[model samples]
Target: MDIKDKLAVDVLVVGSGIAGLKVSIELAKEGKSVLMSTKTQLCSGSSFYPLKASLGTQVTKNDEDKDLFLQDIEDVSHNMHDKDMAKIYIEEIKDRVDEFEEIGIQPYKLSDNRKACFANHGRTIYMLRDWNKIRENVTGILENYSNVTVMERSVVISLIKRNDKIIGAFLLDKNKELILIQCKAVVLASGGFGNIYKHNLNPNDVDGSGHILALEAGASLLNLEFIQFIPGFTTPKYKTLFGEHTLNYCEDFVDDSGNSILDEILPEGLSKEECLEVRSTHGPFTNSLVSKYFDIAMMKQIMKTRSEEGFELIYNKALYENESDFYTIYLNWLTERGINLLTDQVKIAPFAHASNGGVQVDHFGKTNVAGLYAVGELAGGIEGANRLGGNSTGACMVFGKRAAKDCLAYINENSFIEIDSQEELNKLNESMKHFSVHVDHSLTPNEVIDSIRDIMWFNGNVIRDEQNLLSAIEKIEELRKSFNISQFVDNVKDRKSAFKARNFIMLSKILLQAMLERKESRGAHYREDYPSEDERFNKRLFISLNDHELKLEFK
Candidate 1:
């Protein structure tokens, strides 16, 4: 096996998002040799991907409302969040926001009359600068850290564990060569699995590989059933997020056939105006509220038509003259992007936006595995059934810093294991041979991935039931059985695609199994067969792999 390179570091931070950046900075500040390997370039990930102009982090409105902020999170998520984790986030978020401002990524200067969206009360919204600008500011700060070495275009195929401790990781670089990095600790901050769905708003690199890597490394993932789906544009521009602020002004919600889509799915006695008003209050789809029919109706139309071209809406901006400061800024930003809601017939569909759950971690972002930690969207427990809008980014800051500081004790006590390049190369050789070995009539990796996306987007997204979940599981199993990595050892793109295909299969199966096991509707996870939340399943559910078999348990 051609092992491209071998190196050593005190810590290997996987990802380049807000969390990954924060972790690398903290470790570098402590003078620890840190290698930050990103699947893409710096400032690339969900955190820096501009989905909407009004996108920002949420914090407590005031110190007096700290308890209320926690209450809002609990109420919004249906009390499914980890109480301790939520508490940690609430206490630490203000400081993190301050750090952002100090680092030159300041919040937008909105008028005092600007109204908050998403949460009911005690939650203050800090409108962010353009995501591109935020990315520039963050990357600029990272440039000053001389102790950190960045390796881009690297995908972690797996971790190297000895006696159940993470000693290093195997990365496939852009050159299609395996690079091994021996480290005392591995921190996974690789965002979420939104891209696994055919329609999603996450960056292409957010493929849930971190979750799979942690799981295979003997870590548990929590609440895989809860994924947030929100509306995004389907025509003119693909995968652009559709903000809900304009929905209240949109009068005609129709499909290409000129049929009223929302009217078809709206419950009896519920006016379209009332539904739109409630739906505009939140961005993500939730079963706990009546506004859910908005997303359901959109998904129904797409599923019924089986076409990527979704439904359209006509907006009359003149209907509402006194727009909130938030709405005015959002509209202007949309105009800057060359989208005019009044002149444009906007087409939209429910797109997989974020995941509320991931690898289960403690308050310090330490997983069950001793030397492996998970932070950011890769780590679960901060948000539960549904995520509060801004907590996603907030958790990244809080846990990222915490993990970096906490892992020091472990690194101080432990020394590097005595594993050489040849020993690691032998293992890599066996893995490559298993995948590259010829098979009869094998499908391409992209083919398998496309099929996986279709199954996930249709059955596991927006709407779910017993039959469809089981069907998806069966189809996923068939894909797994048929997925023989073609002889493309020297092909870099194809090799990465092959690994991504494998990761998607593992992630899809876990998500489908979790959805089926939940057996009730809760927040973002709605099961039409059991249309109400069951208290028995109220606790967080966790999944782990043992002896290559998936096991799930509820806490």
Candidate 2:
């Protein structure tokens, strides 16, 4: 398990998603030796699954100004978003978009030579190609860089800190052997905590590894309570079948019985355009008779059908057969694009997709800790509450570039400091041994993880109350106790699988604890008990560990 013979680099980028890859590309272009690690393979993160769209307001002469964009973000965030950090993100929007174009991302355009608009911003752009194609193109470019090294199937176990600064990291390679990667700078582009919930759209590997790493390293986190739950997804085994792009096309919302509820909310025969006109007056989800009609009775019917048929009925039919039904139906109406969904109804429900709250960092990506920087989903306070639909891609590009810029600057300004790999190995060995002793028969990792996800979905979902939150905390505590005693049948190499489950449990607890503390319904942190948004809790909520205790403070 010793890594004394391992290699070293100038920069270490963890998680090979868009954020990490972009930073590695930028740093490699600058002639810095960059090493990027992926928990699985490159492009396996959430970035690859996006329906080929980029969201953001690029700097322009008309429509949206930097100040106005900041205002919009602040308004959505309820002032919880860090103004300074948001300003940095706003200032870089145009440059980042232009950079993407320079790197071969040809965006689709309207006849007027402008990108299509979405979410009150004109900067939203859709890719003319598929998302997987974009990832392949970017990967091809990255492979050409001589200074960049790609380590597939490597997991960062812990950050190596020296004198309150990050020196490097202890990594577990594919074979589960410990290897120490010494680097002058570390960029955590590791994505969000969506897997903490049971019915999430995020990958199972995304167990908030980066967040927990930052917390263990004593870095600060903000806005943990603001988990966004997107509306407008179909139910009966929820799946995110439709991209928001189809919002421009579809007009009718159907209940489980396939009955159109549009007339119930709107006057009979009102066109989709007309519905949009009065949508502002009636409120977002309330006016949509479709969401209203899919009530408890509808859900009951779907459950009955599933019980009788031994398969879930999603849309008008079973979803798996009509793989592209939702996409096809919407695209055909929206842009004349063709898609096919078989029997599936494109079942959907809003679950946590991304984290707006993460390790606090400055414009340069420097966290409160001296040598540590966060990028991508790990770096928070930029998007605030509800991230604009396509803005995530832009944010990753901008912040990833900035983090590399600052990291390279740090490397040039400072001298290399050697770390003691033996000491780190000793610490890791002891920790591994402590967990290894619990090999007795008990709950499996999968069972414990399922329990954690179900608890989160039930208690910490879109609507919350003090009672549910408290009950969730108790449930999480009980689960954690079970996890501590859980046994793993797998060997040492597969022990990380068990550890991943444990990590999810710990993060779920933190998320619940943070959500319970926030007593206001601001942005995504909606508490039904405290239904109204409170002016007093208007600022960002900061959570940090104080002597093993989760401490809450407002920024």
Candidate 3:
């Protein structure tokens, strides 16, 4: 079970999502020995179930200009993105997409071979197929590469840095052994922190592991306050199951209690009044509320009335059955003729989905440190304040590849630094023994996790004020203190869950502290007290965490 005696590699890649897989495959193909690790199964991360396809570089008749693409990115990023680093990404888009196509990713194209416009310019592209298929195909290519070793159920506990240069990582192996992986380069492609909220569409393990690891390694984090909130799907029962992205585009809302609340709040362009008339006599639950926040208590009361009076107060039936995923199901409901809910307004509420700001990195995915690099959702300052829909997948793909390529290049140029495995092993042994003995079972890890999620969703989500953020920060700190008192079931599975929950609590504190420092509303970091976005506060915000204390500043 001891992993300290294991072999080393040229590059250590964390998280086997699309980003990690693609990058490792590329490096291995170039004859570099690469070791990739994932917290769970290879495809369990965010890339496997991405609701939409990305808009890559525009293929223009005029010379394929990277500057134009960079300009568009800066515009969407609200001028907060690093212009110099973004240039590298913009220039490589077409080549990257071509590489994917060569590997068998067929992107959907317009009839005239023109680009689609999700933003001001026609630059976005869609996949001709599904994401699961894409993930399978990519995984197959990675599997074929002999130089790459893929390790499943391995979690990266921390980065191994000496004198501010990252040389390797400390990984928790499947057998619960601390593995000291000595490598010339390391890449972090772990996905976002969507699971920080009580109700979110993200998977259970999306707890901001990469972000915390980077911060612990001395990487600079930017725009941690800008958490993206998507206005869609109602999870009346459970938070994780609602396909909010799908519901946002498909349904309409109706406040059937005869209150015209939907008419006042629904954004323009949607036919709100037409749906309102249909719901007045049909009952409240008869219509869908597309973007309006629901009162949880009110929804329960309405459901109760429907059950008692047989009034059919709320129904979530689709207007038409379609081939598309959950989002298309609701879209079909709105566009199709047979669905009654389409004629009625659907209720909608904003929930946290993505983090726009994260650890800042350069063109080669290097942080301020020499040997450390961050990829995927953990590497920030690229999306700026608000990330355009479908761009995250592309960002992960583009940056993941770049980080791996750069890491390999660095290894080829420099010699590997010597590391003492015994020293690392001794430290890990002491920590494990301490954790096993001192850890108490007074409160279950799941209970602590659930409480943190509830507090974050209530205070730090959607709209934030100074008072609420301060209260949330205090609660998160208290949870962190109590986490050590919780005891696992003394099994491998239970221990892993406990470790992940503890990491989540630490991450939640970072997010809460960042939210408290930002006073103005911009992109997804809306502040109720400040109310409006301020031009003077347009620069990016940065935070560094040391021993659980947050040092805040603007970049």
Each candidate: what lDDT? Answer: 0.82, 0.64, 0.62
Whole-structure CA lDDT of model 1: 0.82
lDDT minimum window of 10 residues, candidate 2: 280-289
Per-candidate TM-score against the hidden true structure = 0.95, 0.81, 0.79
- Mark the 10 consecutive residues where model 1 has the least summed lDDT: 108-117
Give lDDT tens digits, candidate 1, residues 1-555: 367888899999999887888887878878898998888887678877877765567776667878877777888777677899998888988778776653336775333422344576735666665667777776677678777888889888889988888899889887768888899999999999999998899989999999989998899998889998988888656787777877777787887778787877887999899988898888889998888888888777666777778788888867347476657767776777787777776898889978889988889999989899999998888787777777777777788889988998789889999676777767655654434435576667888899999999998889898999999999998887776764544565677888898788888999999999998999999998999999999788889998568999988
Give the alpha carbon lDDT tens digit for every residue of 220-326 in model 3: 78877777655333422222222333332333333545454344544567565344333222111201132222222232333334321111123335423445543
Q: Supply the TM-score for candidate 1.
A: 0.95
- Tens digit of lDDT per residue, candidate 2, span 401-485? 8888888888888666798768877765555443343433545677878888887876777666788788888886666555542
**Which of the two, 2 or 3, has more lDDT?**
2
TM-score-wise, the better of 1 and 2 is 1
**How many collisions per candidate?**
0, 20, 28
Ranking by TM-score: 1, 2, 3
Where is model 1 more than 4 Å wrong at Cα? 101-104, 108-117, 319-323, 428-438, 490-493
Model 2 misplacement above 4 A: 1-5, 52-64, 101-104, 109-118, 121-128, 231-238, 243-346, 429-440, 484-490
